[model samples]
Target: MTTSPTTISVPADHVLVWSDEFANDGLPDATKWVHETGRNKEGWYNNEKQYYSGPRLENAQVHNGVLTITARKESNSDQTDWGGQAYSSTRLATLGKKDWTYGFFDIRAKLPCGKGTWPAIWMVGSRGAWPAGGELDIMEWVGSKPERMFSTVHTTAGSGGNGKGADAPIADACNTFHNYQMYWTAQQVIFAVDGKVHFIYKNPGTGVDAWPFDAPQFMILNVAIGGDLGGAVDDAVFPVQMDVEYVRIYQKSK
Candidate 1:
């Protein structure tokens, strides 16, 4: 039998700020989410090649208290009018609807496995867009190596931020459900999986291009098919699913 991960405890002084236990069956809560469609002009960052279509019921659905984001292949004729190879799916985020600055963001999930799956639980700034506003990768996985996971931060400072931070690996990340979490504070950011810390960045530089994270940021959950990061999708792995059991947030008491 598969046991659920230990329940994360919150200090009595701190209150439950936000969460989606995914207890309801069907689409996600409309109040807190918006679908992301089409491929960005530059394609996905980090060389990720997949087109992140907005939320589509066919690609993202909840059942039995679980949220499933599925990626599938189709003939050219089956593709959407949008550009890119013949694959269709969705991306969901809590952008304008909700945003948070410093808080504990945790997601309990089972990643998809195959040559071309790229699943991520991360956050973006609420400002303009992309690297200009900063990007925090709380957790990211490339299906080619199911045993490893990655955590890194991006900014105008570019990769590694003058060599202060990096992408660290976590073993056994895909075999079972793991809680990927990010602890954000005014002075620093910590990334962890299953409660084990992996990466940390401190004293983030300055300005929106450098440290936009200081302001409110929203959450994103996606399982992308072969793209720049995951490499080209393996035709053999046509259908893949990223299963999320729940998401929870906590903030330190004032």
Candidate 2:
């Protein structure tokens, strides 16, 4: 059982530093986001079947104040960049534009409901390689299991199948919008939704292997197709989407 902050809200000591309201309709703001391509690392690259459509409005777009990241069961012959994948999706990141060391992240979004769809709103360290640099997953929801939402921490000391992680039971994940949030500082990271606390990972103070989050990190939002964690696909549910109403970040005034 967990209890503390039961609702998501901006911290009184922090001020808004960066945000994307998605008021302008079209592709995401070029100044704030980039379509990351290579291998979709949500699951393992080889295990994930969705090819990320770079900067394409069909896979990712904003309209009427909502940013939609869609995943579809379709193929484009010109996708040699992604090994000619049979499914297409989007992965947007604030990689080069902005990275943060610690802050309060508050986001409102609705998830896609299709068995095999893996939608995540997470962050990774900006420096070095995986595990060594650290990772903070605010939300990772796989359609194969619609009733639970995951929050995890990955470090060199604890990663992969042994990573420190937990989940919260939620039923209206696909149909309704919820606050997916994180509170990161020098000592710990708190993961929550709608103010409800689900998990926390501390700095351990052991070494970089156990605490690698002191460096900068960037945010990622994407919907992946079938993979190791995504499980089996349901072709009939083609063209599903996760909608983001807004993303706001606040840092303590120093």
Candidate 3:
């Protein structure tokens, strides 16, 4: 069963606590991001076919006020842990750098448009594991269907195919940049594109299994190539990239 999100304009006051404008022209600020390149032994979840390259400028870089994450049709056979995936990409996360319990997030990005390409901006609880810990997928997109975007909430109560979430259509998703946003509070979590709210999950008033958002969660941004969501890739589009303009976070001040 899918959890339906409500639509309402509930404005909450907040102050900017952190942000990245991509003003630097080099690797993402180490203080803000780390290249998460450790899962080659067991292989990535969702049967993804990409070797996440660490600190590789060719795969992830910043220039002209934009952070570009590129997924190239190349193999990193040199790495001892390389999973032998057919493509190489980057996964950047604010795991150790920053984590939040509740806040307002704004991520402006232009998705890549190549069959098999999967890009996502999501969050996970810092102190828990897997579905029980809680996962908030702010946005997930597959290139094959450029018009559709997804947002889901995963928990021990429901995850994977059972995850409760929703999808919305964007006519120019691949062609233009859009602001993917999320508003998380003690009572509920709401997701939006640009200024339009599409998904909202309210506290079930049950227990942690249904509301793991009480703990700190960190954000992740990456372009995955082929797996469950991203069907078969068209090798013709070997070098697809996702351009991220900026990310901002705000929280209520004590």
Best by lDDT: 3
Alpha-carbon lDDT, every model: 0.73, 0.89, 0.90
Give the per-residue Cα lDDT of candidate 2 at 158.
85
Ranking the candidates on lDDT from highest down gives 3, 2, 1
In model 3, what lDDT does residue 54 have?
87
lDDT for 244 in candidate 3 is 95
The residue-by-residue lDDT of candidate 3 on 161-250, one tens digit each, is 998898888978877999998999888889999868888888998999999989999999999989898999999997999999999998
Candidate 2 lDDT trough over 10 residues, lowest sum:
37-46
Q: How would you encode candidate 1's per-residue C-alpha lDDT over 1-254 as one tens digit per residue?
A: 53323333343556668999888888877788787764544455555545555555667888998998877774333345444446655678987788888888889998877888888888887886566667788888888877678877877666443423445465555557788887777777777777766677775456555566787778989887665568766868767778899989888877
User: How badly does each model clash, as a count of residue pairs?
Assistant: 11, 3, 0
Model 1 residue 232 CA deviation in Å: 3.4
> What ordering of candidates by TM-score runs from best to worst?
3, 2, 1
